[model samples]
Target: MRLMRKSRRARFWMSVVVAFVILSFLLSIVSYVWAAVDEVFVLSIDGAIDPAVASYIERGFKEAESVGARAVLLEINTPGGAVDSALRIRNRMDESPLQTIVLVKHSALSAGSLIALAGDVLVMRPGSTIGAAEPRWVIPGSEPRPVDAKTLSAWKAEMEGTASAHGRDARIAAGMVDVDMEIEGVKSRGELLTLTAEQARELGMCDAVQGTRQQALKFCGLGSCSQNEVNMGAAEHMARVMTNPLVAGLFLMVGIALLVIEFFTLGWGIPGTLGLICIGLFFGGHLVAGLAGWESVVLFLLGVVLLLLEILVVPGFGIPGIAGLVALGVSVFLAVGSVEQALITLAIAGVGAVLLVILALRFIEKRNYWPRFILMDRQSSQEGYTSRETGYDRYVGQQGEALTVLRPSGTALIDGERLDVVSEGDFVEPGQKVRIVKVEGLRIVVRPEK
Candidate 1:
C-alpha cells in the first residue's frame, strides 16, 4: 500500500508539470500574435512636397489601409511645393479611409501647412511652427509677389473647406493664406499676427500641441501603437531622376540637336529616332509630374512638326519658322512649374543649340576643304581626261556667254557648244561674256572676258 501511494503522488506531480509547460507555450504564442497585430505604420515626409511626395503618400496610405494599419503618422517637415501637387495630395488625403495624422515635428510652412490641415488630426511638437500658407509668384531677379485677389480667394476656400472638415476653424485657416486678414482680436493695432502653437490652439486651428509621437498615439487611444516606416521604391527613385533640372536640360539639348542634325543630314535616320525619344522623355516626365498638361504636349508636338516643315520643305526661315519657335517657347514655358524655371531652361537650350550649330557647320566645312588642301593627289581620278588631249581642248580660249548665274558653277556656250563651266573668281551674270580657261575631266573652268 505504501509503494502504491508513492507512485500516485509521483504521477500527480508529473501531470502538474506538463500542464504548466503547455500553459507557458500557449502564452508565448498569444503574446507574439498580439504584438504582430498591434503594429502602427509611420510614413515620413521630410523634403519639399513635390509630386513624388504626393505619390509616395498616396501609395503608402493605400498600402497601410490594405494591411489594416491601426494608424498612419505623416511626419512632416517641408517648406512647400507646386500648388497643383499640394492640391492633389490634399484631395487624396481627404478621400482616404485610413486614419491620417499630420505630425508637424518641424516647420510646415506655405503649401506644407495646407497639406497638414487636410489631415484628420494635426499634431505639433514643442517649438514647432506652422501657418505661412499664402501663395506667391516667384519671379527671377525680383521679390515674390503675392497672389491676386481671385487666386487668394480660391486658395482660401480650399483651405477653409479642408480645415472645416477636420473640426478646425475655417476662418482662421483662411486668414493664414491671406495677408490682409485679421482675426477680430488676434491682431493688435496695425499688427499682423502669425499664429503660434498656443495661438493656433486658442483659435481652434490645430487639434493638439504634442511633444512626441508616443504622446500623439496615446491621445488617439493607441498607447501601444507600433511604428513602421514607408521608404522610397524603384518607381519613386526613377521619378526623382527624371524630374532633375539638369537631366531635363540635358534631354532638351540632345533632342534639339538631334532634330537639327536630322534636318541637315541623311534625310531622317538615327538622329531622327534619337530626337523623338529624347523629346518624348522630356514631355512624359513633365506630364507625370503634373507640370505639363495634355494641352502643353499637343502644342509642343505641333511646334516640332511646324519647325520640321520649315527646315525641310520651306525655301527659307520665314513665318512658319517664327510661328513654330513661338509655339515651342510657350510649350516649354508651360511644361515647367514656374516662369523662372522655364526661362532658365530656355536659356540653357538656346545656348546649347547655338553651340551645336557652330560645331556642325565647322564639321561640314572641314569635310569640304580637307581633301582639297591635304589629299589633292588621291582625290584626282586616274582615268579622267586632261586638257592636253581631251576633246574639249578645242574649247580653250573660246568666248562664251553664261546662260545661268555663275557664283562658282554655271552654264555657258563655249564655241557654240553648251558646256558646264565654273567661274574663275568673280560672279558672272547670266548674260555675261566668258572665256574658257581650262578643261579637265569634263570640268570647264571659265573667266569673265572684260
Candidate 2:
C-alpha cells in the first residue's frame, strides 16, 4: 500500500512538470506572434515623385527592415513626376521583405498610379482618386504632352505588369495608360481612366476604402501595431526643391545673370556672392538627389577656372574661353540627365538670364550706382588735367629710367612725369636708363640708353 502511494505521488509531480512545460511553450509562441505583428512603419510620399522621393522611400525601407517591422504603410499624394523615379520606387517595393500597404490619401495620378499599384495591398481614403498613368513630357510652364506610340505601348505593358503582379486587373491598369483601351462600362476610347475611391473598390483595384489612416491600418490587420512615421530630412527636402526642372533652371539663370552683372559693373561683391550661393544650391541639391556626381561638379569648377584664366590672365578669349563654355554646357547637360530636360532647362536659363541681366543693368543705371562700382570721375583739360600725349613730343629726346619691365611696352619716368612708353624691338628691364626715340600721337617709343 505504501509503494502504491509513492507511485501516485511521482505521477502527480510528472504531470505538473509536463503542464508547466506546455504552458511555457504556449506563452513563448504568443509572445513571438505578438512581437511579429506589433510594429508598422509609415512613410509619407507627397508632392511630385522625383529622385528625392525615391531616395526617401529606399531609406525608409532600410530603416523598417532594421527595426524588424512586419509591414510598411505609404501615405501617397502626388500629381506624378519622373517615370524613372517612379520605377525606382516600385522596384524597391518589390525587393523589400516587408509587406507594402499604399494609402492614396489624395490624387495619385500618372506615375503615382504606377507606384500605387505596385503595393501588396492598396487602400484609398474616402474621396481620394487614382489613375491617369499616361506617360508624358512634363515641361514646366507647358502643358504635358503624350509620349510616342512606342513609348506608350511599353509604358502600358509596365503598368499592366505591375498591377497584375498583385492580382489586380491588367485591363484596368492598361486603361489608365492607354487612351485607346476601353473597359466595358468603365472607360471609353480616347479617355484615360481615372477612378474615385469607390470606383477603385468596385473595379477591384483597391482592397478597402477607409475614412482615416487608422481605419485603413485596421483594415490591413495592423490596427494594434505601434506606428513609426518617417518624415523627409532636410537634405531630401532640398533635393526635391532643387531637382525640379523649372526651379533648377531658375537657379542657373539667377546665378549666371547675377555673375554677369557683377562682372560688367563691380569687381566682386553682393551679386557675385549671391550668384555663387545660387550655383552652389543647384549643384548641392543635384548631388544629394544623385542626379549630379562629383565628376560633373569637378567639370564645372574646371570650366570656371578656365573662364577666369581667359578673363584675368589670358589676353583674349581663345581656346580656354571656348573650352570653358563647352565644359559648362556639358556639365549642365550631364547634371540634368535627360536631353530634352537639359535643353529645356538650358533654354530657359539662357533666356531668363538675358532678361535678368538687362533688368539689373537698367536698375543700376537708373540708380546712378555706377560711381560706386566703377571709376566714373573723368579728368579733362577743362579741369587743368593734361593728357599724357600733350607733352609726349617734348620727351622725344629725353632720357628716362624704366619703371616697369618692358616686353615691348612699359612705363618710363621721363623728366619725372611717369610717361607710358614702348621699347624699340627689345625687352627692357626695370631701373634701366632709356631714351625716348619718337612720339606717334600718344605712343612714346624708347630704347635702352648707352
The most accurate candidate by lDDT is 2
C-alpha RMSD of candidate 2: 10.0
- Tell me, by TM-score, which candidate is best: 2
lDDT (Cα, tens digit) per residue for candidate 2, span 81-189: 8998999999999999999999999889999999999999999988999998889977788787888999889889999999999999999999999888888999999
Error of 1 at 439 (Å): 14
Compose the digit string of candidate 1's lDDT tens values, residues 1-450.
Answer: 999999999999999999999999999988866764586778877877766667777788888777677678888888776676688888888887777888888888888888888888888887777777888876434687877889888988988898888888887777778777776776533333356677677777778899998898887777787788898677565555555555677788878887877666644577779988988888777776656788888998888888888765663467889999899889988887666677767776778877986796688677784343233454345667333455887788889899877767768887767787888767888898999888875778999988
After superposing candidate 2, which stretches have Cα over 4 Å from the reference?
1-37, 265-267, 315-317, 377-450
> Looking at candidate 2, what is the lDDT of residue 319?
90
Q: Which 10 consecutive residues of model 2 have the lowest summed lDDT?
A: 309-318
| Candidate 2 structure lDDT | 0.89
Count of clashing residue pairs in every prediction: 0, 0
